[model samples]
Target: MDKYTKIIEQIKALEADMVDFKIVDFYGRLRHVTIPTTNITDKKLQFGFGFDGSNFGFAETGKSDFVARPVIKDFVELDPCLEDPTATFMCDVYEAAQDVKPYESDPRGILRKACNYMQSLGVADMATWGPELEFYLFNDLLVRTDPQAMSAEIISDEGYWGSQDDDYSFATRLPKKGGYHSVPPNDTQYQTRVEAVRRLTSLGYDVKYHHHEVGGPGQCEVEFNLMDSMVAADCIILGKYIIRNTAQEFGSYASFLPKPIFGEAGNGLHVHFLMKGKNGELVFHDPNGYMGLSKMALSFLAGILTHAPAITAITNPSTNSYKRLVRGYEAPCNCCYGMANRNAAVRIPAYATQPEEKRFEYRVGDATFNPYLALASILMAGLDGVKKSLDPEGKFGPLEKMDKGWEPPVSIPASLKEALEALQKDHQFLLDGGVFTKGMLEKFISDKMQDHLRIERTPHPVEFEMYELI
Candidate 1:
């Protein structure tokens, strides 16, 4: 049998009652349409399914028609979260016009174009990424937005402050900022994360490890092994889906928000990447270079550090993202780099000694990012740096060698508005090679500005606290 027939047989073996086509929206959310498995056919899968793109925030209503075509090679035999047995496949969005071209603004399409552009330039055959997923698991969350009263409360049994009135409570509660790798009673989400990892493994994710993070209030992390750029993006989306649903199944809620609580460790999505040549040789490792990084690697690092302010407009898009970048949270506030320095935006892992394992980590990003756009923009910026042969040595630095009181030349953007403004002024690198279109960048800015404005117009509880007595 051919591949199509084999896919049909596999679905049949899964006993799936429905087939779901999953597509990534402009904002990095997974939206889908499902059809009865019996109704699926080779032609329908090949031709595609129609959807309204305006609903996905992709276009105006009049020009909203789009097609989602299943990527046959990318699929899950059965979705573990849905009540109904379903076969799920990741899809590519295309225009519904007479020519049926790939949608230019599609997030996944943009990343795919970036990868292809890299190949065409003959710089590297492919780029690989490993994203460290960090999040919080809350036992319950309550929010009230009434005119008379506005409040938000987080309730987690594992939190030290959430102790019951009963005696001997101190022994069980995790101390503030002391939950890192704490076992059992202090780490209530252990089994839940184990099951989540089990589900992810069943779905073909190469999980490196899962553990409690430094937040005393239910913060958790799951790290994945390196994979190609496109596949890595897919994993980030699916991983979040599985994690959230798994949390729900365990009677909890999972949040990827950068800063959910004050005076606590916050979530971050640090990405590690490296490039390989057409002959499959590592393009980033050089025995004679600094920290075993080749000149190209240094230039790539320079590109990201150079464009970080603009890039955060996508990688750290949300208004609250900057809240996590504050001092004392281990988040990078400066554009400098250092070996194993958590305070630097780019950190060279001390453990990755082998040439194949050598790679750099960008610590400035958060989970608020739309994976495709974030990774693509970073790659584009780095490639631009490589093309220009930008030198990172004297400027951004190996921060460890700097004098004790020396300040870096640049800092990461302090707020969303600032980052967006930076992008508005410096997005030429993204426009090159047609990977990221001008229209897409414009829409992204317009939409994100709306987010900033909405937050600005709202009155916060803290404002009430400070002004009520006065």
Candidate 2:
């Protein structure tokens, strides 16, 4: 039987009462509808279920009608905590009239187009990506933003900064930035991480590892298995969902905010990627070459470095993201690459010893990005570099040594304004295959600029403390 037919049958056999047809929106939010399991048939999957797109920040109120076509390959079982047994499936948005797939405007459609573009260029049939999911687990989170008052507070029982006050436990606490690899009891959230990993693995995602991060307060990271860019993006969305839900089960909250706390390590979504041929051979591996990187691979790295600043507008969209990219915090602020250098925008991980295992990690992105747009944009930039043979002169340094004299010809943008400006000027590379259209680009820029203005007009709570004494 076909995949959808089998899935429907399995849902029935499992006594599932509801099925959730879900999709990740442009802002990385999960949008879905829970319908009776009886309604999930092969024909229904083919025709799609209708929804209001306006609420999703996608359409005008008058023309908000849209359809969601199930991507059966991206299906996964729902968590058992819900009242009814349910299965969730990722979907693609389609226009109501002709039932045609939406273009760049639809986040999922953009990912599809990027995949097609890759095929068109004969670059690679698939690009695999593995994103290291880092987040903060807090005991309590409170926030208020108003014209009269603005403040935010977070509490963590295991936080290094707050642990000293815990008279209940006399256990010695690690100093600031010393939380990495701390053992059980001191780690505090070890069981939480284990549960999160277990849940993710049960949902068919391969669990690489889970551990406490450098952030003292319940900061942790869970690494998922690598898959094609599209599938990987879907996993990222689902992974975030599972992490948050699991945290709630433990009476805690998990946040993917780039910088959730001051004077602490920031969370990052470090993405490792590999381009391979259909034969399952590593196309980017050249052991005899520098850093075991092939010509195509070097060109791809060059393209990414050249477009790194512009890509940030989408990859690190939020204003708060800039706070994490500051120097001395292990954030990648420079447009450069090196072997095993976490501070570089791109780093070739030394962990991969086999030929097929070789890949490069782009360290600049955070979890705030829409995975579909971010991955597609990065691929488009790389493809453009290959097509034009764009050489990233002096951008990549030796793997073993630090090149103090080396400076990137193009500097990465330090602020959202500069990043947006870079996007405005350097987005032609993203337009070659129409993976990212002019209209969508314009809308994205306009929307982000509006967000920038909103934050700029509002005075920060810290500003009051600084000026109140004056």
Q: Return the top candidate by TM-score.
A: 1
Candidate 1: the clashing residue pairs are none
The local distance difference test score of each candidate is 0.90, 0.81
TM-score against native, each model: 0.97, 0.94
Off by over 4 Å in 2: 1-5, 74-76, 80-83, 163-173, 398-405
Worst 10 residues of 1 by lDDT: 163-172
RMSD, one per candidate, in order: 1.6, 2.2
For model 2, name the residue pairs that clash: none
lDDT of 1 by residue, 293-348 (tens): 99999999999999989998999999999999999989999998999999999999
Overall local distance difference test of candidate 2: 0.81
